[model samples]
Target: MKKLISLLLNRLTLVLLLILAQFIVLVWLINFFSNSWQNIQIALMVLSLLMVLYILTRNDNPEFKLAWVIPILAFPIFGGFFYLFFRAQNLNMKTRNHLYNVVKERQYILSQNIDYGLKGNYKKIETFLESDFWPSYKHTNSIFLPSGESKLKVLLEDLKKAEKFIFMEYFIITKSKMWDEILEVLIEKQKQGVEIRIMYDDFGSATKLPLGYYKKLRALGFKVISFNTLKVHLNFAMNYRDHRKIVVIDNKIGYTGGINIGDEYTNSTKTFGHWHDAAIKIEGDAVWTLTILFLENWRFSTKEKISYEDYYLDYKVEKPNGLYVPFGDLPLDKNHMAKDIYLSLISEANESIYISTPYLILDNEMVTALKLAAKSGIDVNIVIPGIPDKKMVYMVSESYVPELLLAGVKVYKYKPGFIHSKIIVVDRKVAMIGTSNLDYRSLYLHFENNIFLYDASSIIDMVDYFIETIADSVLITPQEMKKRNIFYRVIQTILRAFSPLL
Candidate 1:
């Protein structure tokens, strides 16, 4: 009973209920006036026509434009009003301006540490990344962890060596064996006068942690903040989330990838069948790039000014013979650089392109790019999970398989369990591993981060891991997809039509 009451009184739940109530009242008012007066009907029609014109002229994704147009055109009476109210309630110019200034200042500090001499093909990649202020480094040594258990062991060992500060930002942080062990070390480190700060997404950890958990951490002498707290009001800014998983230790070591702070990521908890994930541990000057990324978001979340040089490490290490570039993407940015990076890899592949993602809901541009790459006889392949965590999303993922197979792209599903790794390897020469999935939210609407490797030794290991993972997957053929029932096809079409919103 207490649990139910707590859930009912939750801030997120209350806000959702209030929005629903307003929607119901709006619908009733519209219907009553439309039936009793002609002037109301004419006004609604004119408002909807203006909205359609605005949507058509805006520079947005085609899929998203279609999703909004269909509903507004089909039901003009209520749709236009709803769209206006939703847009007007969430104007966050202050937050956006603050974040822009923080990024501009940090990027200037990071550009000063870039290494200029590039080898063969790395020169092209370096030039491309630098066009957007993402600098490439040559002093970082990267370790590729093929599984969550391996990553956890190495992370715990690295946390013991922190002397200055620890900065952690993740989408989700649950109270599980994984977090409990790490928390113990953090508490002990606090006693030694080490600075520790954490930031997490409120919506991502809504059900896992209590309402006042950040306060509890503050009481324990740790600086913590919840990103974008949920309140009882009408707001659309909640849709934008912090999805990047980053950890920086003393500005000397950094980690980023698909794994989160939970037992499910380690396969210790069986939410789905054998969970598979990956992470990258980088040690060297490249860590400074990730440190800047974290501090930018930290400043936005806490409204605190941080001196970039205070956390910067000036010592040198044995420089590795490769190029490592770490970059971040923001939803408000016009570039949409994550999708551009993936498209560049696809377009530049000479022999093969391999990708692994948990979800495969893609827009038309991505679909066309994949199809073209495969039709060029370039051995394009993708691996997704056979055991799903979200049924609707899995259906939408499967809906794209048939079209891809018809275009000569090969698709595989891991037979053992869920594969939560987000990776892309091109021609076994360039590779990326990070938090961005191959879906709309990751590509277009969330803050994401990834590391690009040019001639790094980890590329060999990543290729080998991809081959091993493919061996355990089941291939899907066009003929097999054709055998699905008609009703299933209809449902798939419906889901695909609305995938932009998903």
Candidate 2:
């Protein structure tokens, strides 16, 4: 009870309340004038028409365009204004161009000289290479981490060996057991003259960490940034959050996946019962890609020029593993990079597809691709949480279950607790593990990161782990979904309609 009250009184709470108050006032004023003034009503109607026409021509998901069109027609007076208010970028034009320039300069990483005999997967890999400007590496060693606890153990051990610098970026980080242990190691390493840089999404950490948290971290002799700080304003820029989880040490080793720096991730607080998550470590040649991913974002946030050559190191791993491609999905980019990779994987898989994700709010393209894969007699399985972290998102997931089940796609609910991992293993030969969920937000809205790996021995271990998790899950039959009453189904349908916005 005390904690609840304290949270309610936090600065984030106060700022949110202020934003809500402003929104309500704006809506009230618009509604009042639209009813009273003939000129105002006509102007708003014209605005609504223009908005609908503009939305129709956008090169985005058709479903997303339909989602917006519904509201614009229903509340013609306020809907267009609301759309403009939310879609407008808060950042100035100069800043936007600078962000673009930084990424543009890193385009060289998209091409690599070293090649491999990836016989039939050239088209699948080329999407990341040409579209997103991410290279596929040939000589990197990777190890699969099955759980957050496992990642933490390996991460702490690796952090202790940081010789030059450590770059850490995540969507969420709170003051907790997991963070404390990592911070202790980081502090000791900083004292030893190892450079430390930390970046996290401000909206994700706003309530958990105090205001100006980065300033506090800087005081402790670390370079830190609270990316996209939460402001009491209406802007779509806040929706484009940095949802990537990365830990790059000395440009020699890197770690990434669904895990975050929170006690719940490590199952210490059990915020969502037994929290299930995963992360993987890449050592040798490919770690450089992870390092570059961090440095690009770090430069964008900090506005500091980085000597790319200074961080370059030719790492050598004994008994090196298979091909690895670490890439990030930029919300600002025209192409839906991660979603395309997922589609290629589903379309190319000849045997089976195993997936575990916390959210399953997919776009039409993904849904169709999955259904086709299942209909082709391929073993298709998706494991979601029995206990969800977000009920609305969970219901949105449940809304898709009926159609998916009918199409022969098997869906399972993990019985133990909320499974936060985002992983896809195809044909026991290729896998993708990372922070991008099987949801609209991860696919189209948030900045996300994931690794595309092929022919890695760890792929088998990941598949085995997914199979073990399926054993602990309950399969959702078609008849089982029929048990939901009318009211429950209606609510789910409503959530699904606006899911793209979420």
Q: Pick the candidate with the highest TM-score.
A: 2
Error of 2 at 446 (Å): 1.1
Clashing pairs in 1: none
Computed on alpha carbons, the lDDT of every model, listed in order, comes to 0.85, 0.86
TM-score of each: 0.95, 0.96
Model 2: CA > 4 A from native: 27-36, 109-123, 126-131, 234-237
| lDDT tens per residue, model 2, 130-168 | 455676677788999999899999999999999999999
List pairs with backbone clashes in candidate 2.
none
**Residue 46 deviation, candidate 2, in Å?**
1.4
Residue-level lDDT tens digits of model 1 in 166-277: 9899999988999998999999889999899999988888767778899999998999988878754453545568899999999888999999889998989988898988
